[model samples]
Target: MGLKKDYAALADQDRERIQRWSVLDEGEQAAILGDLISSPEMEALVDEALAANPDLQQTLLTLRIRQVQYRKTFGDRLPEIKGGYTAGKEEDTDPSYTGSLSIGWEVDLWRKLADESRAAGKDAAQQQALYQSARDTLGAEVMKAWLELIATQKNITIEKKRLGVLEKNEAFILGRYKNGLGTLEDLDSARTRTASSRASLEEYRENLARQRRALNSLLGREAGPALTLPADYPTVVPPLISLPAQTLKRRPDLKAAYLAIEAESLRASAAYKALLPSIDLEAAFEDVADTPGAALLTDPVWSVLAGLTAPLYQGGKLRAAAEISGMETAKAYQAYRETLLDAVNEVEDAVGQEQALKKQVRHINTALASARSNRLQYREKYRAGLAGMLDLLNVQEQTYDLEQQLNNLIHERLVNRIDLGLALGLGVKQ
Candidate 1:
């Protein structure tokens, strides 16, 4: 028990949140999740999730590593310097001493280093875009769970109210049976109807628990209390909709795929550059003295040489590497195309759902109103013996079904609204 907390604290100390939710103790997880559920809005919870998600943080760390790689490749442009001292006592000579300095620079006559650095920098940018994409997706999922939890809560309330009505009617039917005004079948049907309502209420409660657990998981904690959403939380579909300009710029995943292409192209160019001869300028100085302590080498005793190295033979490995890089660049383009298509599909589907759900809500609201009215008339008819037990039960079931469907429609409209925002690439920053 103590070890779990110790491990969680240790993981929290890491620069990158690499540990999974398993690191958290069950009680600690519940406490943290309860606070998120108590918040006024899901935005705060979404921010916490994105900030605390270990996978997202690891992606950022990976980005930083790529930046370091860029620096190392660019640093190759700087000169390489070394120095050494030698002292020895020979049998035929006094203490002999020597000091030396050497410098070598590639001069980079062709921009090979620059190309490699550019590729590395672009990869870092791509990872950055991917991280933002993850943030956008996480926020959308949180909102969706919030919507489901709210709808389930409302449905439970509705079910309880309906249960109250059924139980009250059952009591009235029992009194009528005692007076010989209603048949045994009618009394039994009322009791059966009340029992069904109870069962429905239990089902709603179970679903509510499931939704709460899902919300907690997104917050990277154990399941906790049910979260209540505000009444005004975007359930109605918006009237205005417009196609965004330069849509590709909005999606981070698409941008990352595009950056991959350019980065790979630069890398391919650098690979070809590797096949050419490399020219380096070398300079060195040496000094000798009779004593162990010798003066350092100076310009007065120095030599310089311009060296060239050509890849004369490598069993075609160099050529193969260059070819592989070119193929990777081509593959990047295909990935970019695939990502673009997926982005387009997501946007269209979100838009379609928003449109369809908005119309469905209005139509369902009308049907629900009619169902409520019809059920009221049937209840009265059954009490007076004009309607049969089966007829009353059928009407009651229909009314309950309509009420539940209405709840689902409202939730769907709200969820689709959130999905549209994510599909348009809003709410996430890179």
Candidate 2:
């Protein structure tokens, strides 16, 4: 059987809507599956999620705001200016409009401004690392959806093939019964088996359709056209890589954790520097125009001054801040180490799954071959009256089961390959 009846006759509009479905090769199908998993639509949804994903977006936005803060931290090294008008009528003072311009600059001693800037810069870098971590998570989710769709489609194909074989066998047994050469029990058993296979095929088709819809939802799209899949789906297998070399740097979560630790360390340093004294330089000018009927020129008053200030006590707030920062730094360091270990474990487990599935594939293939050979031999013997119909039926059933098992093994192999790729931080290839 093909797909469902409703899916059989493609309307002109429907067919035109999905022109790509008509010309899909196995490789193209695989590529399209990858695209559906990681399409722009899906990426856009991820961006939206990132915007609303409180924990992540908060960290990212905070990092950006901190970049501005870091730049402002250097403000202590630059001049500040103010311009305003002061107009009032006071007791014993003449009513006049006074306009004044003032400028103040803080001299950074002990590189405090430099340290704060470095800390802020580190905070921004940490945010970048967090964004990368989000990306890695989204990538893994996409890979999972893609693999599941592939598995469902493969299962449907295998079930359909078995159903076809069962129908053929049923027809043959029914013919023999009509010719009085087969028992009623043979006919009934064949019919029952055929019906059961049909029911299972339908179930597989339904499950496949459900998975397709779920994948479409993940891609941020309404269900579209039918998906075509590779005829020979590859098994999952890990590519060789130097685990020790890649674990820390290549894994996004681990990198993010490390950056977080760096950020916290820098923050701690900046906090300690907050307790020192700072110097300030100030300058100002006033320009007044008093016209006596027709004036020729105006005189302006200008002055310059410098000052320094030191903080004596603020109830130990600054010292407490430094202590808190130190604790946060230590916490970040612990988190970084934990993330590294987790990444290593994930890679090792994926590699193990790949190896185990490869062995399974070999055994399933061997079993399929033997079962097929036995089915063929038994059919011939039954036709020659050298074997009973029951013997032929049993062989056929065994062959069918083995074929399905092999199909499952093949699908498992492909899933393992995908898992390995994800573990290695590889995106789906074009």
- Tell how far residue 253 is off in model 2, in angstroms: 2.9
**After superposition, candidate 1 runs with Cα above 4 Å error:** 1-40, 85-98, 170-196, 222-228, 231-245, 288-295, 298-301
lDDT of model 2, residue 248:
40
TM-score for each predicted model, relative to the true structure:
0.81, 0.70
lDDT of each: 0.71, 0.62
lDDT tens string, model 1, 150-185? 788888877887898788878887898899887898
Of candidate 1, the 10-residue stretch with the lowest lDDT total is 22-31
The lDDT of model 1 is 0.71
Residues 202-310 of candidate 2: C-alpha lDDT, one tens digit per residue: 8888887888777555555564666565554433334444335443456556556666666666667667767777777888877543333112113447788877677
RMSD of each: 12.6, 14.9
Q: How far is candidate 2 from the true structure (C-alpha RMSD, Å)?
A: 14.9
